[model samples]
Every structure is written in C-alpha cells, then in structure tokens.
Target: MNKYIIYLIALVSGVLGVFAFSPFDYWGLAYVSLLGLIFVAKTSKKSTALFASFLWSMGFFCFGVNWLNVSIYQFGGASLGVSYFLVGLLSAYLALYPVLFTYLVQRFNVQSAVIFSVIWTFTEFLRGWLFTGFPWLQLGYTQIDSPFSGIAPIFGVTGLTFFTVWASASIFNGVAALFNGKNPKIALFNAVLLAGVGGLSAYAQRIDFVKPVQNEPLRVTLLQGNIEQNLKWDPDYLYSTLEIYQKLIAQHLGKSDLIILPESALPTLENALVPFFERLDRAGQAADTEIVIGTVYQDVHSDKLFNSMVSVGNPNFPYRLETLNRYSKRHLVPFGEYVPLETLLRPLNSVFNLPMSAFQSGAVAQPPFMAKARVFAPAICYEIIFGELVRQNLKNDTDYLLTISNDAWFGNSIGPWQHLQMARMRALELGKPLIRATNTGISVFIGAKGEILAQAPQFVETALTYDIAPMKGKTPYSVLGDMPLYGLSLLFLMLRGMMAFMRRRMNLSQKP
Candidate 1:
C-alpha cells in the first residue's frame, strides 16, 4: 500500500470516530477507528507510526471540537483568520497526546493489548487534568449509548476507554493472525474473550447499583429561555430577559415542585433583581413552590461576582433573601469565565472583553441547594464535565443533581449535544436523577441509569415537566471514584514492565 494512502486512511478513521459520539451516535464505528490505529502502528516503522498517529489525532480533534471556532468567531467577535488559527493551534496541541502514545509504544516495543490499553487510558487521564484540561471528545463518551455503558457505574469513563481500546486491539490482532493462516488457537481465544466482555456488559445493565429513596416524587420544570449569547448580557435586553423568565416561572408556579432556569437566565446581578425576587417570593408563598434561578451575584464587601444558582421562596423560607440558599459555580472556564493572564490577554480581543468574564469561583465545599425537604447538588455549565469534581459535591442525603448551562455560545453546533451527554453519564455514575436546564435547548431530565427521560427541542423556547424519583445509595463509581481504575492501569503498566525485564534477561542469557 502507498505510504501517504495509509496516513490518509488513519486520518479518515479518526474523522469517522466522531460519529461514535453525540448527534450521530454510530458507536460501533469506534472499534473500526481504533482498529485502524492498531493496524497502522503494528505494520509501520517507529517514525511512520508516530506520524500516522499524529495525523489521526489531528483529524479527531479538528473535527470533533470544530465547534470551538463557532464560539470564537460568532460570539467572541474574533476575526475569521484568528478563529481558525486558534482552532488549528488547539488541534495541534491535542494531537501531541497521540503522538506521545505512539512514540512510547514504538520505543518500548509494546505488543501486549493490556499494556496498550493501559497506556491509552493513562494518557487520557493525563490529558484530562494537564494544563487545566480540555478533556473533550474522550473515547469513552462515545459509548454512552453502547452496551459498554453498563460498566460506567463500576469503572467510570476512563475504565470504559480502557476496555474499549483493549477490545479493539484484541480483535485487530486476532483478525490479522487468522488472515495470515497462523495461530488459529489465538484467534479463537480472542473471539471468546470479546464475547465474554460483551456478555458482561449486557449483564451489567441489569444490575441495580442504587435504589430509589422513598420520598414524594419531585415534579420539576426545566426552563429553556433560548436567549441569544449576543443579547443575553446586553443591558437594554436585561428587562426582557428577566420578564421572560419571571413569566415562565409564573406559568409553572403551582404545577412544579421545583422550577429550574438555565445558567445566567437572568442577565443582571442578584442585587439588581431584589424587587423581582421579592415578587417571586410572594408568589412562591402563595403557590407553595420553589424556584432555582441562575443569575450573577455580587459580594458587596469583596466586590466579587459569582455565577450562581439562587433559590427563591423555598417552602421553608417564605421571604428570605435570595442569597440564603445559593450555590455558586466552583469551576469556571479558563478563557471563557476568566482569562488566565487578564493583565496580558485582556487587550487582545473582544473575547477577553466579554461581559462579566471575571466572575469569582465558589468554594469547593459549599452547601447544596435546599428545596422540598431534599438536598440538590448544583453544577454550573462547564463544571459538569469534571466527574470527580461533581462527585465531591455529592452527599449521602443528596436527592437530586442539577446542572445549568447557557450553550447559546455554541450556537447550532455539536457542542451542546456533547455537553448534554456528559451530564447523563454523571447521572448514571451517581445513580441519581439529573435535571439539566440550558439556554437554546437540549434541556433534559436524565434518569439514574443514564436514560433521557424528557428533553426539549434545540433552539426553542420551551419547558419540560417531568417527575423524578430521588435515589438513595451510591454507585461503585460514586463511592470509589476513579481511584480503582487508575490503580488498575498503574498495576498493568508495572506488570508489563516486569515482563519486559524478564524477557530481556532471558534473551541476554540465551546469547551464550
């Protein structure tokens, strides 16, 4: 085969892998994608393998996260040239991870499927946390709707990545062996192993990791205001935005036990909305309902602003201040929420000059939102992507998980759908119902098992009403977190290293 043709095949495989994720959801394609990687690396020289993998990763990130350019050019007011340049730079940087993976495998001559899977998973873990982490388009996220998703509660997303890569490599090696008319027994063993893994995944779907807590089912209404990012924070549109949400809340006042508005649903600060909150308090007192509104809150003394979720008129407090039951966003997006080096980057473009871009992060150990005699953990927008961070906020008595986002920044891109899918994975991992409210749609209620119970249309002004039974007990992933999976990956690496050492010693001794 032509060398450039092979590289093009690798790139195409990576592009096809994107279909395995949201919107397309052709998950089985992921196997074929990884199989291409395995075949290229096995057949090519070290340098060729490294370059091929880099090409594949470049294609993967370029296509998958192309939505980044949409936000940068459309909303951030960057020039088309600057937006594409930045996107290209990001794709190149992300591609380096695969470069490193391929380089290590070639250098070490790692042929074991177990070792390859471990290295792949460990690299993913590193990518998630390094440089404040971009962690988008993780391989495991593609399996959210696949049979493999059943193991998410046990091993989390990283574990699913490990198993997925392992299965892909195993099948590729086995097929190659059979085609060469050698090692028929090895091919048969690989077939059986693949079957066993699939069988286990299917079986895992039936296992109940958590039970429903015996409480009155909560009737929740998630509101999508469908606000445009350009006008969301414009001072002239503030009154209309507030009125839109206020009227939406009023319509669901008596019908819902809890009403949720998307993040920054109100364009103004909490201090500016005192009268509106007071009016809502009176209405809530009459309706016996609780409202969770997403708005900015300013600290009077510190002069700091927070992207916050404030509960108004909880049955417990009829006329308390809106700040009484507020949960501020702890994890703020690096460039979006607050520029890294504001002193240097502030003057670069309108993106850094975004309104309210310098908001303060809430405390990591802050209290959950209280409503309807239950505890609700709240994550604002980008914070939902961090599994461990979200797990840290979960409590023994926490009844529901709530995430609010204004994805209008992503426009009609795949970014919103991918974000929604991650939220569902979190719900499945925790064995709790998740209420997700978003601006410009994909607002949904996800069940404990990661099923989308109800969803609103994208880019639409609508509200979804659903009854969610709060769950008690914790899933394995919730209890142990990612520690067990990380430990297993480390163990595999150690074992492979020892085996490699033994093989070297045997070869040296046999040289005599």
Candidate 2:
C-alpha cells in the first residue's frame, strides 16, 4: 500500500474515534480505528510508523475537542483564528503521546500489537500525569457501552484500552491471513483466542463486585441554572443568579434528601455570601434537605481563591458559617482553572484573563461530604475525569459519586455529552450512584449500575429529581485500582522480549 494513502486512512481513522465516543457512540469504530492504526504500523521504517501515529492522534483530538474553540473565541475574547490555532496547538501537544509510543516500540524492534498496547497504555498515563493531566477522550472511554466495559470494574478505563488494541490486533491478524489465503494455523489460533476473549468479557458483565447496603432510597435534586457565561461572572448579576438557584431549590426543598448546585453556582466569594448562604441554611434545615452548593472561597489570610463545594444544611456534619465543611477542587485545570506561564500568556489575549482563573488547589485527602447521613465522594469540574483522584477519595462506606461542573464554556457542543458519559463511567466503575449537576444543563442522576435515571436538556434552566438508593459496596476497581493494569502490561512486555530472544538464539544455534 502507498504511504500517503496510509496517512490519509490514519487521519480518517482518528476522526472515526470521535464517533466512537458520546452522542454518536459508535463504539465498534474504536476497534476499526485501532485496526487501521495497527495495519499502518506494520512498517519496517520508524518514520512511517511515527508519522502515521501522529496523524491518527491529530485527527482524533482536533475533531474530538474542537468544542474548545467555542469557549476561546466566543467567551474567552480570542479572535477566531487564534482560537482555532490554540485548539490545534493543544491537539498537537496531545498527539505527542502516540508519537512517543510509536517511537519507543519501533526503537525496541518490538512491532506487535501486545507490545504496542502496553507502551500505549503507559504513554496515556504519562499524558494524564505530566502537566496536571488531561485524560479526555481517551480510547477506553469509547468502550463504556461495549463488552470491553465489563473489564473497567476490574482495571478501570486503561484495562479497556489494553484490550481494545489487543482485540484489534487479533482481528487484523486473523482477517488479513484469511484474505491473503495464507497462514491457516495462525488465523485459526487467533479466531479461537478472540472467541475466548469475547466469551469471558460477556461473562464478566454478570459479576457483581459491589452490593447494596441499605433498603431506603435518598431523594436528590440537581439544579441547572443555565446562566450565560458572560452574566455569571458579572457582579451586577449576582443576586439574579442566586435567585435562580434559590427558586430551583425551593421547589424541591421538603421533597429531597439532597440538592446539588452547579460548580461555582453562586459566582461570588464565599465570605461575601455568608448572609446569603445562612438564609439557604435556614431553609434547608427547615425542609430536612442537604444542599451542596458550588461556590468560590477566598482565604482571608492570603487572599488566594479556591473553587469549592460546601455542605449548606441537613447533613450528618453540621453547617458552619465561618469554616464550612467543604470539598475544594484539587485537580485544577491548566488553562481553565489557572493559567500556566501567566506573565507571557495574560498579555497576549483577553482569553487568558478570565474571571476566577487562578484558584489554588485544596488540601489532599479531603474527606467525603455527608448528605442525609450518607457519605458522598466529591469531584469538582475537571477532577471527575481522573480515575485515580476519584478512587483515592472513596471511603469504605462512601455511597455516592458527586461531580459538579460549569460546562457553559463548551456551549452547545459535544464536549458536554462526552463529559456526561465519563461521569456515568465513574459511577459504573465504582458501583456508586452519581449526582452530576452542571451549568448550561446536563444535570443527571446515574444509578450504581451506570444507567441514567434522569437527565436534563442542554442549555436549559431546569432540575432533575430521583429517589436514588445510597449504594454501600465497592467494585473491584474500588478495591484495587489501575495498579493491576500497569503490572500486567509490563509483565507482557518482559515475556514478549524473553520469547523473542529465545527464538533468535534457537535459530542461530540451528545454523549450519
């Protein structure tokens, strides 16, 4: 096959990955995309493989996260060209992960799907770890609806990633040989291997790693204000914003066990809003409702700001005005939460100087907040995407996964859909119900089994109410996280190297 044709196919394959994710959710495309990548990677030359990998990732991120330009241009005050450039630059930066994976695998002369998958998983971890981590649109996320998803409870998203690559490899090897009318034994072996893998994965879906702890259900309300991004940060619109949420909560007051507000729902510093929160506390206390409000908090001593979630009322932990029981956002976004290299970037454009863009991270190991005597693990905005962060916050009795976001920035794009899908996976992976409340809609109640109980429309001012049972058990993922996947990947690599070395030695000895 011609190399340029291969490159074109690689780019298209990457874009195909976009459909494999939320909204479109053609999950089988993920395997097809990987198959194209594996076919292109069957090259003897290193540059060809590396270039194809980069093109593959470029198509994936550019199309997958193009919604980013909406915020940069429409809200962040950047010019249209600049916004597109910025989005491309970010996509190009992410593309380096696949490029690096290709380089290493090619360098080591280990050109097999199993080896590539191992290296691929490690590079993904590096991408998420280095520079505050952006684990969005990862290949594993595409498999939430596929049979591969059953493996997530065992090893999280990375487990699905490993198998996606391996399965694609098996398909290519088996199908290609059959087409070429060559290597009957090899094709037959892979056919049987794929059958076993599929059978076991389907069986794994029946296993319940987590169990119910209580019979009683907790009534919950998620508030979506749908306030436009411009007015949300304006001090003039403060009372109006508060009133919108106040009315939403008032409707569900006595009928709910918990009420959740979107991230930064108040749009003001916590100190300045004490009287307002106090009023909310009184209402929640009277109604027997626990209100979890996303608000900004400032440290009086240092004047540093933090994005935080406070327990307002009706909780096992009593509400305090001065020092509220809260979960401050720990995983701050690189540009969204805080600008990197502020001096140079801030002067470049108005986009860099967005309101409350420089909030400090909260303390690590912050305990889960309580609502109606049930423990809830909290993740704010971008923090929900990191599986490790969510895993660490879980307690033995944590009953729910609570993630709050202000996704108005993405506007009416696929970004919110992808974000919501990930939130569902977190619930499925841990066997805990999820309460996701977001500004500009997508508020949802997700069951412990990863099923959506209810969801609000995008860009709509609304609320969702569900009587969700607080789950009590943990999934295997909850017990042991990505450590198993990491160990297994390295083990496979080492065994592959040993087997390859033995083969070469045996051939050399047999030479006459």
- My TM-score estimates for the predictions, one after another, are 0.97, 0.96
The CA lDDT of each predicted structure is 0.85, 0.85
Q: Kindly give the number of clashing pairs for every candidate.
A: 0, 0
Compared with the true structure, what per-residue lDDT tens digits does model 2 show for residues 390-469?
98888888888999998899888999899988888888888888889899878999887678999888888988888888
Q: Kindly list the per-residue Cα lDDT of model 1 for residues 1-512, writing each as its tens digit.
A: 66797799889998988888898889898888898787777778877788899889888888888888888898888999998888888999998887777877787777778778987886787888897887888788889899888889988887788888999888877888889898799788888988888899899889998888676789999999988888998899988887788778889999898888899888888887788888897788689888888888888778799998888766567644435678899988887888888999999788777777899889988876787778987889999989888899898899889999998988898888888888988898888899999989889999999999998999888889998898888899999998998898889888888988899999999996
Instruction: Please list the Cα RMSD from the true structure of every candidate, rounded to 1 decimal place.
Output: 1.6, 1.7
Worst 10 residues of 2 by lDDT: 315-324
